[model samples]
Target: MGLLDSWTAGSHTADGLTYPTYRKGSGPGVIVIHEIPGITPGVIGFAEQVVARGFTVVLPSLFGRPEGPASAGEALRSIARICVSQEFSLFALGRTTGCAPWLRSLARRLHDELGGPGVGALGMCFTGGFALAMLADAPIAAPVLAQPASPAPLGRARAADLGLGPADLASVKAKVAAGCQVLGLRYDRDPAVGTRFDTLRRELGDGFVAVEFPGRKHSTLTEHPQPEGVERVLAFLEEKLTTKPET
Candidate 1:
């Protein structure tokens, strides 16, 4: 059986789109969107940690083989496919992916079923900024963007867009004003993640929590797995999802 087979497997239908999903654990809800190469071992490992931390983690397999091993060949194939897929805006600046609405619906359903303060979402690699995009819905209390490398990261415009259109960007900003904090992670020298960090800082101000690492490693939770990053993410999730006595 695939590693995903060990998790509860199902399908979610949202905004007339259906996708395979995996879930494990119990508590508040957290949607963990995988990178371009799908639900690879490394991504699964990260999700397992989230589950162990007491959140019901939901992973939607957007591309690549579900629960596949992380390999250069597979990564290249997934990248090529994503480059041509209309569901994603490979080189478009300031436009959300076609998949965003569907993801937003999924987040709403997860929050409706497993409520706490709200839901947490972590999007990595090509889908990184998706956590931000999902903020169009109000239930996303904590959004984590890890190495959000989309639009091929080619030019300044693409680097600054954060894969969001103007209206969605407005919604995200409004959410920040409502006390929904966003967490971002990237390497100091990863060309895949251009100046979007600066954009986020400027756009969200104190609402943006940025964790920058030295060198060129990408994929904070998977591929390059940083222990500190993992801990920071978990702490952020706990802070947002846990219920505290009213002071």
Candidate 2:
């Protein structure tokens, strides 16, 4: 808590893409994945909140960040900029070349530098499935996947850009069979990820901890103040990351 109050930000690149990062606290590491827009102050605030709970926080701008600090208006403007940009690089920011290895390298550095067994990962909205995809690498011990967007059309049939393929899904199944638990948070509504994710829930079964917040929509879990879900998620992280080894 004391360390995070005076926290500072940093910049780095992962998977051959440049990204702005934030660091704080002084214990085991946790990677805080940003929402669709980027690593806004609200997301950083969330990182700080997690740091206050006594874990070191690492935030990579999956999408590029602003030249200045990001307020809501700034973040909204950034979204517009990306939407209007010719290339829309924000969507490709952290995903350059080989993303899985990039995340694994970052985790390795955090574990070796921070002196922890491994790192926890939390992804939101568009990037939610990433935490699960990352589980293929094994360094992602505790994964919190929130409101994942579609990887491929969904609904009565297929879904676009749902973010996982057969191999990735198979690896996840293997991890679950090995007793690894994954936590997922979502609101009852949000068609973009609604029923498709529910199917995944059934697919994963007991290996997945599904925490659905009634009446809330996508991304409220990461943003907090919803009168439900966020605090419960914090508790869930505590349960997984802070679990005692029973010998």
Candidate with top lDDT is 1
Q: Each model's C-alpha lDDT?
A: 0.89, 0.65
lDDT string for model 1 (107-219, tens) is 88898898778899899888999999898764898899999897677867887778988999999999898788999998889989888899999999999999999989888
By TM-score, how accurate is candidate 2?
A: 0.78
* Prediction-by-prediction clash tally: 0, 15
Give the alpha carbon lDDT tens digit for every residue of 40-144 in model 2: 555766777778887888887556553334456655766675566442232332131135566667777787776644678888866676787677765767788
TM-score of every candidate: 0.96, 0.78
Which residue pairs of candidate 1 clash? none
User: Model 1, clash count?
Assistant: 0
How far off is residue 52 in model 1, in Å? 0.4
In candidate 1, position 123 carries an lDDT of 93
